[model samples]
Structures are given as C-alpha cells and as structure tokens.
Target: MSLHELRLLPWTTPEGNPCYLSADSDHSALSRLADDLEAAQLDSGAQVLAGARAVLADPGAGERAVRFALTRAVESLDDALRVAVSRGRRIPARHR
Candidate 1:
C-alpha cells in the first residue's frame, strides 16, 4: 500500500518497550486516536525544542537541565523516526 494511505502511531508497552501500530485507512477509531496522539507528540516536541533552546541560551543552565532537555529531544526524535518508518517511504540517502 502507498504510504499516504497508512497511518502510523508509535506507542510503548506497559513494560516500556517501544511499539507501533499501522492502519491502511484513517477513518478507523484507532487511526483517529493515533492521529491525535501523533499531533500532540509533534507539538510537544516543538515545545521541547523551544525550551531547550532557551535553556541553552542561558549561561546558568545546569548540566542536569541540559541533560533533561536532551533526553526529551531524543525521545521526540525517536517518535518522529517511528512515524516516518511507518509511512514505508524510503528516504533518499542524500537526505540523511
């Protein structure tokens, strides 16, 4: 199936293992829920990036604060990666 027709949602199991679900159609209840969650996660990631930039600009920002921001950023990046992977699109090597 074409990537555009698929909806991918990244999630975690109760044990904290990363997981994902994919649906060919977006009208399903699960697909809608996944859409909502993905939107929220992307928004949150943007917010985190802003906050991290602010913290980085502050000379007084402690190591712990920077680490925390980095951690969140990494998690957000992973989520984005999962979303992209679920689309089943082959990213060009030059883009990497």
Candidate 2:
C-alpha cells in the first residue's frame, strides 16, 4: 500500500524501543495523540531556535550557556525529526 494511505502513530515499547502503529484513518485516538505531540514538538523547536539565536548574538553569553542552548536545540530538532518521519510520505526514486 502507498505510504500516504497509512497514518503512522509514534509510540515506545516498554523496553524503550521505537514503535509505530499504522492506521488507515487519521482520526484514531492514537493518531490524534501523535498529531498533538507533533505540534508540540514543532512549537518547541521554533522557540529553541529563537532562544539559540539570541544567545549567539549576545557577546556576554558564556561558552557553557551557548552549549546548553545548543544542546536543547538539538533535542528539539530530534523531536521534530521524529514527528516528521512519523507522518511523512516516502517518495520513490525515479530510475536514471
């Protein structure tokens, strides 16, 4: 089946392994939850980018402070990536 026909729900197993559920409808409870989580992650990434920019522009910002901001930004980026992968469609590459 085409990836667009499926909705991927992100979840974690008890052992912390990444897990996903594929459903036909986007209105399922798990799909709705995934959508909410994705929105939160995207918002967090945007906020972190703003904060990191501010920190970088401040001459008084110490190395530790910059590093901390970068770390958080990386985490936010990771979450955003997870959310994107969960909902994104895979396009087939054309033959050369």
Candidate 3:
C-alpha cells in the first residue's frame, strides 16, 4: 500500500519500530482497536500529568517520589506525542 494509504497504529513493535495498519477503511477492527488505545493513552497521560503536578507541589515529596513522578510523566508524554503524530498523519492534506 502507498504511504498515504497506511495508518500509523498507536503501538510500536517489540523491536521499538512504528506499526502501520493497511485496512481499506478506518472502521476496520484493528483500526477501531487502535482508536480506542489512542484514547486510553491520552486519558492516561492526563492522569499522569495531574499526579505529577501534585507531587511537584508537595514540599515533603522525597527524591524517590519526585523521580517516580517524573518517570511516569515522561512515559505519558511519549505516548501522547506518539498518538498526536499518528493522528496528524491521518489528517487529509487539505485539512492541514
């Protein structure tokens, strides 16, 4: 399939490569699954951000606590950015 026909899936392969879906329609089962996963990833990122902010605002938060929050925030940010890129690629050229 041509690059424009391929959809960038929400998850990566075990080798850390981007995954693509080549369904004729976006309503395909795999495409729906990817949509659901992307929504979940965004939701999780929001939750992580809220928790990280709480940790940062706490004067008593220990080094470990801060580090853990930072780590989770980073992971969530990565997932969110991946989702954004994937969605951006799917938008029609005219829309951009």
Off by over 4 Å in 1: 1-8, 16-24, 88-96
lDDT (Cα, 0-100) at 68 in candidate 3: 97
Between candidates 1 and 2, name the one with more favorable lDDT. 2
TM-score of 1: 0.72
Q: For model 2, what is the error of residue 21's alpha carbon versus the real structure, in angstroms, after optimal superposition? A: 1.1
Q: For model 3, where is the 10-residue window of minimal lDDT?
A: 1-10
lDDT tens digits by residue: candidate 3, 1-96: 243477888889999999989877878799899999999999999999999999999999999999999999999998988898888888888898
Candidate 3 has a TM-score of 0.92
lDDT of 1 at 83: 68
lDDT, residue 72, candidate 1: 90
TM-score of each: 0.72, 0.75, 0.92
Model 2 — which ten-residue stretch has the worst lDDT? Answer: 87-96
**Please, what are the lDDT tens digits per residue for candidate 2 over residues 1-96?**
243454444446799677666666567788778778879878989999999999999999999999999999998987877777665543233521
Clashing pairs in 1: none
Q: Which order, best to worst by lDDT?
A: 3, 2, 1
The per-prediction tally of clashing pairs is: 0, 0, 0
Candidate 1 minimal-lDDT segment of 10 residues:
1-10
State residue 25's C-alpha deviation in candidate 1, in Å: 2.9
